[model samples]
Target: MVTRDSAWPGGVPCWVDLGVDDLDRARAFYGELLGWEAPPGSPETGGYSICLKNGRAVAGIGPKQGPPDVPPAWTTYLSVADADETARKISAAGGKLLVEPGDVMDAGRLAIAADPGGAVFGIWQSRAHTGIGLANEPGALCWNENMSRDYEANLAFYRSVFGYDYDDMSANGFRYSVFKVDGNPAGGIGELGADFPADIPPHWMAYFAVADTDAAVAKVTELGGGVLRTPWDTPYGRMAILGDSQGAVFAVIAMPAGG
Candidate 1:
């Protein structure tokens, strides 16, 4: 199990949260599926629900504040030493700034941005809230990946903005790269497969750690959520893609011991 007691390093994926249409339903579904207990959110923080596992912060669920047409999705947030400086670098690297750097009360400062390939993500400068308290453990985040049509362009944007180093893992016609921070896996980038519909834009997908992939997928189905892919084994672990009851997509994996 990987546990954290302090802020993450710059450019590391330190947090993730779902922006859902119905906060109550999201809380219920995730609470049942991931064994999380969400305490009452303080109004001072806009009623954002923080999901906790074993008394530690795991993730968040909040009401979607985007346009009415926007669908619920998970946003991956990377840690930064300076939110304002990272926002500037995002613009200079050909990305569009969605929300300017702003403080979330005294919790931290954040900004939303999209890569040139249209993958939206967030940058966080931690203050009182230092992001996820437990990760790489059951019911917590394990991996985050971005799928884009123009993989090279998006790769260049991230490298330019964060000075990220990647380990190319492309093989057998599949283009994939794992970005690392200080020798630890930060996230992944891959070219959207040919099977992906053209209308689907580039996006980031978060993966939660589970003790049993097949069992988790079963629970997802039993809860009225559909499984996008049956559990399958990969070199890294066993994984399955799935969508929540509201169609918010995510993945779950059971990593090999110590992997």
Candidate 2:
């Protein structure tokens, strides 16, 4: 299992959170599904719930922001050395800042931005609070990836902003690459080909590790969530896409040993 007590390296996906219409329901849903414990958030931070697994920070759930038409969604955050500098790079690289760089109390500073293709993600400069405490274990974050409609433009944008290097994995008509940070796999980028629904916007996907993909999918249904895709086996794991009761999407994977 991967664990960290401090900030992650720059460009690594260090955190993830869900913005939901009903914070209590989201907290309960994930608590039961992933064996997490979510306590009420401090009022100073707008009651943002932090989900914990094995007493370690795992993810967050907070009241939805933006217009009512904007559905609840999950966001992946990359660790950065300087959020203000990263926000500048985002604008220079043709991306838009949804939330300008600002401090979250004394916990940290952050900014939310969207790529040219409109995939939204966050950049975090850690302070008193580091990112997630545990990962690559059941009930914790396992992976993150960007699915982009304007594949090449988004790729260029990320490389320009974060200096990401990628290993091309495109094959059999699929265009995909694993982005690396400091010579290690950090995340991935994949083309949302013609087959994907046009209404689906480009976005970052966060995956949580599960011990049993099939069982977890069943639990999601039992908890009133819907399955976007049935579990299927890949070389790395058995995985499925799912939406929470409020329609926030995420994936769950049961990795092969040591994967």
lDDT, residue 87, candidate 2: 94
Q: How displaced is residue 140 in candidate 2, in Å?
A: 0.4
Q: Model 1: clashing residue pairs?
A: none
Writing each residue's lDDT as its tens digit, candidate 1 over 1-259 gives: 7788789999989999999887788888899899999865887756689899998898999888689999999999999999999999999999999999999988899999999989999999999989999988989999999899989998899999888899999998889999988887789999987877787779999999999999999999988899988999998899999999998999999999995
Q: For model 2, state the Cα shift of residue 78 in Å.
A: 0.7
Top-TM-score candidate index: 2
Least accurate stretch of 10 residues (summed lDDT) in model 2? 42-51
- Model 1 TM-score is 0.97
Per-prediction CA RMSD (Å): 1.1, 0.8
Model-by-model lDDT, in order?
0.91, 0.93
Looking at model 2, the pairs that clash are none
Model 2 segments more than 4 A misplaced: none
lDDT of 2 by residue, 148-249 (tens): 888899889989999999999998788999999999999999999988888878999999999999999999999999999999998889999999999999
Error of 2 at 210 (Å): 0.4
